[model samples]
Target: MMISDLPADLLDEILSRVPATSLIRLRSTCKQWYNLFKDQMFAEKHLRNVPKQLRVLTLKENRLFLPSVDLNFVPPSIEFSDELSLNNSNNSEEVHIDSAFHCDGLLLCTTRDELVVWNPCLGETMWIKHSEGSKRVKERKPMYALGYENNQSCRSYKILMFWDCDELYDGQVDGFKVYDFNSNAWRVVNYPNCFIMNSHGVNLKGNGYWNAYDDNYVDYILSFHFTGERFIRLCLPPPSQGCMYTSLSVVREELSVLRCVKGSSKIEMWVTTNKMDTSASELSWSKSFTMNFGFPVLVYTGLLIDEDKKVVLCNTIVGDHLRGACTIGEEDKYYSEIAFEGMSLSQPPHIFNYVPSLVRIQEGTELDVFGKSPRRRGDDPPTRRGDTAMCDHDFQFSQEIDDMMS
Candidate 1:
């Protein structure tokens, strides 16, 4: 009763359950097992079977370690595709991230206690005015939340920026602000019921992750219908006290969320069919198979794509531990955990643009309402990199670099 002899579907299921490293090692087990695992149909199924989670890559050792074992898509031809260099000229705006979340194929970044949305595809940047809030003027990361809505005529994404305006570290929030991509401006809004925030920023994946105010004092998934210009709350299964991971993700025809337990091997999957209806709150929590085979640490930090194959591409962090977003002792987790000084020693700048989220939508099309600043698209393919100063330009071996370093 070897693995090769099992039914093909069953064998692929078992293979999908294993980690990426273990699956690669299993390729040497047998030719039949190897071929079965390598099949394209099996690849799609394996991606669906694995958890839809996020992968984080730290800037260490001049490389990015890819962790997609369940070959979801034909791996793109890229070699050590992580280390990127700064043009210095292109980086004049600072583009500091107070808080950021990805939605509708773009990044919503907040800074200066204000909000700025960027479309990396079109190379567009827009400064959205922040609505009036706490008068204290304390500086912090602006965690921006984004979501999409569709109508008979068009579709638009909403950017919501949440921050502490009060000068005091007290829990009372001064105010909340909102930005509409369609109007191309920011509007002030009344404050909603405050909820607990995940202190560490490493766990942020999608922008519009929120909960509805409930009797148990927990947040429900907040949903905005763009066409209706309305807000609805998604009733999610309650989170366990010991759980360190929870995120909103979509599975097939249903909207779902993932909750992971710390120091344990399994993550719970909750799929919803109710769509934006609050009447369907049935107080029932469902369970799914274990993903990663250990504590489901990095759920929303990776990339998941469903095309010819269901591939979850994960970028693993090199050093340090995968910290929880909201920890007990530490708060203020705005994702930009590292700081870099720009060729100067004073005024430390918290660098937030490092973790690159590879979002894939329709190949030829993108949204227009998100504001596209027209720029000549460069046709040059990204260049290969090496162990020197980070750059995309071809560098001839020269002693001038040596003298500059000395």
Candidate 2:
């Protein structure tokens, strides 16, 4: 029997297991399959049933380059794939993305004039216009984060637009706004000026996290809970002295932090021991492994760790000049440079782990959904950063909290 002759449910069961990239290309072959792939129910099934494939995405001059990675090799292997164009319309105008945020298989990208949420795997894009408040602060080019709230089987996605005011956070506190996909509108949200958000933000299980410091210069993890529409602070591992760079990544479904110390070749990896518990009094972190590259890694860079293989794939600087990507293994087990064909290493490109999904951005009236009201802050003990004991305010986020298998 022809594949098209299969029963409707049977066809969905088979197609749901196909990789997203393949499915996207094959959708044009059959009208029935095209409509089925667009069905929200089928998308959910595809998300739950299809195995995830992780790839490295690098953005250069608004161009997206996806490179295929092979971890079975010693130093690991990466090869150039394709340059993804964001412009899917008949107009030939190129899309220039200033920055991009990833959450739940969708990317929130900002350009010189507007913002858009994109599912590159499915070749889908949704434009989000700025609010009046956002336009007034356009010169600042407000930072953005994409996240969602899971209310039972439904997922409500939202975009957070806020300004980075570390220099003036103590005074003239600035408020932030949230753009609800369901409502297709923006609303201002209260901002807590107790801490200053720093560095790039990462999303974990529908929440947004960033490296932050307080007035006392204590560094911690700042988390914005979308479900609660409130900010909460989580603690980091004991601080490292002369730490020149810090970056966060989600590894094996848990949070991981990479600390690169100044003038030192030693890089330490810390993993959180528990899943994200927003209400926990303290988050725990344990040292995973360390990499000694024999040369100081002087800049902040993105990284992905293979827990079982004991290998780390990350962007690196060579000879204090050239930029490149490499894999670092434990105790001299291996170290090798990944060469990308036809891609420039002249500038450091943003790198992150990505899994394609069929999750669609829903549009409708906003639901009156709110999470358990913000947790009451208590007198938590001071969190230690190196030797300094930071006065742990209830809202100050922490570092080093991760998911470690053992």
| TM-score list, all predictions | 0.46, 0.76
Instruction: Give the poorly placed runs of model 1, Cα more than 4 Å off.
Output: 1-98, 111-116, 127-136, 139-141, 148-151, 164-174, 198-207, 211-219, 224-231, 238-245, 252-254, 274-286, 292-406
Worst 10 residues of 2 by lDDT: 397-406
Clash count, one per candidate: 19, 17
- Model number with the top TM-score: 2
Model 2 misplacement above 4 A: 1-15, 68-81, 88-90, 131-139, 165-173, 240-245, 277-281, 317-323, 331-333, 337-348, 363-406
lDDT of every predicted structure (CA atoms)? 0.38, 0.65
For residues 162-187, write the lDDT of model 1, one tens digit per residue: 56433354333334455555555555
Please provide, for model 2 over 1-406, each residue's C-alpha lDDT reduced to its tens digit, 9 standing for 90 to 100: 9997899889889998986655755554545665676677788788778886555566655667665556666656665445656773336466877677888678888866567778766556666556432333533437789998767767788888887543333522255888877666678888675666655688887888877777787878888888888887778888778664367777766778877777788888888888674565466898888888888774345666466766776777655454566777675745777643344543356666666776667733344223211111111222332212222210121110010100
Error of 1 at 191 (Å): 4.1
